[model samples]
Target: MSLWVDKYRPRSLDQLSFHPSITQNLKALASTGDFPHLLVYGPTGSGKKTRIYATLHELFGPSVEKLKIDVKTFTTSSNRKLEFNVLSSPYHLEITPSDMGNNDRVVIQDLLKDVASTEQVDFTNGAGNGSGGHGGPTRHRFKVVIINEADSLSRDAQAALRRTMEKYSSNIRLIMISNTTSNIIPPIKSRTLLVRIPAPSSAEVASVLAHISKKESVKFTDSNTEPFFEAVANNCECNLRKSLLCFETIAMQTAQINVSNDSTSIIKLDWEVIIENLAKSIAGNRTVANLAKARVVFYELLSHCIPPRVILKKLLFCLISEVKPSMATELVSIAATFDERLSLGQKSIFHLEGFTAKVMVALEK
Candidate 1:
């Protein structure tokens, strides 16, 4: 069986549950035949990808949903082979920084240039087949290039992307997805229409949980399901994807959700628990031995593919509670410095370790 997150995901703009205004705007843009490049950014699990796909579906009909994964290889200046997966359909393609590595500028430019040189022609309909008298083909004039984790893109790659956007404006539309625009350069930001999608409120998240529960036929023993779902929604911090997975975990264990008895423990993701333990270690004492131990844990988290910025952010949230408000303010500044360094430097461990040591020193002072 497919995961509930995927099974219940909204496929079209009309079916989207939250952000009615954004939905309406996307609909109007799709109706305009084509639009300028878009930078759709928001927090994690905020349905940014969902809205982008829905907009694509609206523009290209069902053909946009016929997705396929293709692995493309490029040769680097050092003659090394860099292979990356490209998810695409007839109308759009999706790529990420992980796919291009340090050679994103070259790979992205070549890929987009190839796509821009071709005109999209739909053969399924006579009107789109250029068969009609004097009107030419009625197919969509452009294809979309979706850049996921655009914030993680290096400065050189983003510069190359800016130039590509200007050169291929006629036949290619770029949609960049990022958690934040703090790292995005100004030139690209100016070229695209910025769409910021905020995270759903707790009440909105609870309603979605309730909808999923009813559809799944899961009955709560509690007289009112509000507290049960509200608890889940709050526990997941209003992250819809995380909320669904949390609810499904509970449903699998027992259909009867009891809010009063404290029997249902919200399952914390393993990485979260690890970070919590790391915070406790820091809180226990600020010392060389502890810092050494913390380094090992940091390496473990990074090895598991957790982004350093995310680790640092969560680590700050955990550490803030253990210190005074004034110290917490100081800690935020330290984290902010390391965060910028994490984005600019190649070695994440250096920045992460540096942040930890600085926190230890600050706590001591």
Candidate 2:
């Protein structure tokens, strides 16, 4: 409860961990209900969900205690349809994936249909008499549907969801969170009150870390300080979630490497060091980077147990940025598709690199 990050999470709209203007827009939504169908567009692990949660918690606390908020939190790939009716308490409900599924278009469709139907959940009490909610007998008529990774939704799914959203506007408010809003349908965009949750500024991030250090009762040394910040900023390209994860990972490494709670000696790990290890293990960077150390490095990377898609993403990024400009765009577009295929579990992890020849060419530059 006292973790610095959580403790310091902007409790009020004014206190959000970002620009005052940004939080003000969010605060207005929380207090006034003008958030339309919100598209919280930004990278993952950013504060998109936090702000939403804060909004919900603040907006409906006493009422939420009285009226259940049935939340269905699933990715684009689940076999079951979520329901909200028979709950004992009229509180918030969340549906999260038990297992991750592939990024195939079909998976996207299933996600759309299930989520589009959120407006129709029967909040009726299980009693055949029709009065189970509110500790009396009737359920209220307010609902919010949140979709994570809206950018990953397929075009067709997006179209379907748009229609459903339009049809159900009176009963539902849709919020779609994503790394980028460009992938969302324009029709959906037109209806929703778009809110920008910008990445945390470096100063904000440091403040977060420094605050966390005190909360965790850890000591910080000067030498590894910059690296700690670097790791957080790098993981998601400044996504707070990933940064926190990287931060925690560094802390764990420190604890393990030193066998002491001495946070002062914690050595921050570089993103490249992580990339290098993973590449070595999977034999990914064989043709470039380090021929002499390929096998061992690949082995080391594999030993670290980096996920295939992460490896693929890294490989893709390396190619796009490090390679020649001639076909970088084409390579990136194809890689995005490949990443989808990998997520849909439609393709093997090893074959993802097949989409990388263009990238490989770029790396050669």
| Per-prediction CA RMSD (Å) | 3.0, 8.0
Clashes of 1: 0
Best by lDDT: 1
Model 1 over residues 277-313: C-alpha lDDT tens digits? 8898898788899888888998999999998889999
Inter-residue clash pairs, candidate 1? none
CA-lDDT, candidates in order = 0.85, 0.54
Off by over 4 Å in 2: 1-14, 62-140, 221-237, 249-310, 320-345, 348-351, 358-365
Tell me the spans in candidate 1 whose CA falls farther than 4 Å from its real position.
123-139, 262-265
Residue range 1-365, candidate 2, lDDT tens digits: 44334555654444565667776666565554324678887655568877776666555443333434344333433554433221113333332221223232343345444544555334443222111112122222335666666766666666767776777665656677777776677888888888877778665776676567657665454434555565456544666665665566567555422323344323345645665454433334536444434434434555676555566677666555544577667767877876766544433434444544434444445
CA shift of 28, model 2, Å: 1.3
Q: How displaced is residue 111 in candidate 2, in Å?
A: 9.1
Q: Tell me how many clashing residue pairs each candidate has.
A: 0, 22
